[model samples]
Target: MSRMWLCAVSLAILCALSLPTFGQTFSRILFDTDMESDCDDAACLAMLHALADRGEIELLGTMISAKFPWSGPCADAINTYYGRPDLPIGVPKGKAGIQQGSKYAEQVAKQFPHDCPLYDDAPDATRLYRQLLAAQPDGSVTILTVGDLTNLRYLIESEADEISPLTGQQLVKKKVAHWVCMGSRYPADLDPGKWGNFKPDAESTVKAIEAWPTKITFTGGGKFAELISTGKRLKELPQDNPVRRVYELYFGGNVKDRHSADQIAVMVAARGTGHPWKLVTQGHNHIFPNGTHQWEVETDNPRHQYISALADGVDPQEVIDSFNELMLHQPK
Candidate 1:
């Protein structure tokens, strides 16, 4: 071949090598949740594990933001049931966090098979975040929070340790692609203390969001999420399914459908919008001192996004069906 032709071929090969391959399509998620407060968290975990089974995503670890003793074990039990028994589980050891008891966490932990017996026995979420992030390739992990932002706040404020030389903020900026938070009401929450995730640890929410170095997407259970009640179909799953038991216990044995805030957030994290949903990426999220938040649209704003309404002509049931199907998914 002529020298000019050989140069052109070499350049084409380099471009092809630089392009993303199918292996890079799957998201590596570090899931953080305030388990035990709501059955939706359980549903979210089950859905995520199912997605992992389908090879759409890889779950790096699960962190419990709730202080309840059973929260860690409940998460572990669900992870175990999904055949990921070895997945690392972390719990917040800091003072700023939620400590509420759950309607199902204790029961699920007691009835299911798991290795994490106590919340305190698990590693600190901040430390785990550092270690997990330090080990991942830069800009390859997605930090998905479906509960309080307490752990994230702790992670951002953490100092250099034996895990890595970089500080918490630096490590996050280096490793995390973006953060998907399932908190706050859409547009604005006129009621300052209404949202559980933000209100209980409002200070942490402010600290985490303010200092976060990457793009942040805030998703909520209000609006479209409230319209998508789910888990009623859990009755169809075998009694051995821990998530099914979670729904039953949460409803006092009724197993009725419930609003899906965290579940929707999980869907958005795993599969980017357009499963009948879209993202409003032009605004920034403004969190108040009292924990309520609002989205202010700015043409130049590019770091924040909020889950918006369904695409035109899309039926609400389509989302409902999708959530229910994932929740009812059989463990692989």
Candidate 2:
């Protein structure tokens, strides 16, 4: 080869070597949500897309763990509004899963400009999870949830299939790094039995907790008073923004008295505990099938912990602001 041709070949090889290896860059996230009852699910969806738009994370897809009339469309509407209408979506249409009614999903879908004509028209979340996880490199993807554990349980219990030869738990153990979620009050502040998401699908939640052989991080279940999130401010967005509209319908244009657990968890998943956020990993979480759970703090080695308050001197307002900036962020 001539000197110039060899130089060009070497340059091409260098460029190839510089490309991101599935191992490089931001965390790969597969977000699962129970969009049935909370508008924060929509807000978290917006934040994920915002992070994606900024190249902070690659949003593999979103799955709706709860079944509602227009849950899938509401998610699609947000994805479409964010200029990523082609993003894959999944939902459960099975009787074994949690089925909850949504106050906003149906209305938002009917009023929004998205292309989803039917909510259940989407694929199954379990299958989607398997296919997505199977294709990802080992310990490279993060499955973040802001909803019931039904889907997590179902996905964990899924058997080996064409997607990959690995069983559900095996696939998770081999592929997923950890689970970032927003549910179940920690420290036993409230009865774990009555915990919101866990009890709705208690059996599934228990199964999910037992099946997963990895670390699970929980955040925002009436524990972090410093991370309270409100959608009243999101109501300020112009009427065309479907996310804002979803909030309006849920909170009745009032952001006060609402928690941002789901949004904060998603933000933590995207931005990590870089500044204000901190983790309490000194202990593990204790979950039960009756919808009750608690954080067992231990000084010895432990595996689970929820999000603690802001780092020392970090204003509590900044904590919520972090969530607001991303949750209400517009697509760039």
- The numbered model that scores best in lDDT is 1
> What is the lDDT for 282 in model 1?
77
Query: How do the predictions measure up, each by TM-score?
Result: 0.91, 0.86
- The parts of candidate 1 lying over 4 Å away from their true place are 1-24, 298-300
* CA deviation > 4 Å runs, candidate 2: 1-25, 117-120, 189-195, 223-227, 253-257, 298-301
Q: 130-228, model 2: which lDDT tens digit per residue?
A: 988888989988889988877788888899998889899999999988788787565663464454777787788778877787777777567574356
Score residue 189 of candidate 2 by CA lDDT. 39
Q: Give candidate 1's TM-score.
A: 0.91
The clash count of every prediction, one per candidate, is 0, 5
Task: Summarize candidate 1's per-residue lDDT along 168-275 as a digit string, tens digits.
Answer: 999999999989998867877869645558888889989999999998888867766778888888999999999999989988887888889998888877876544
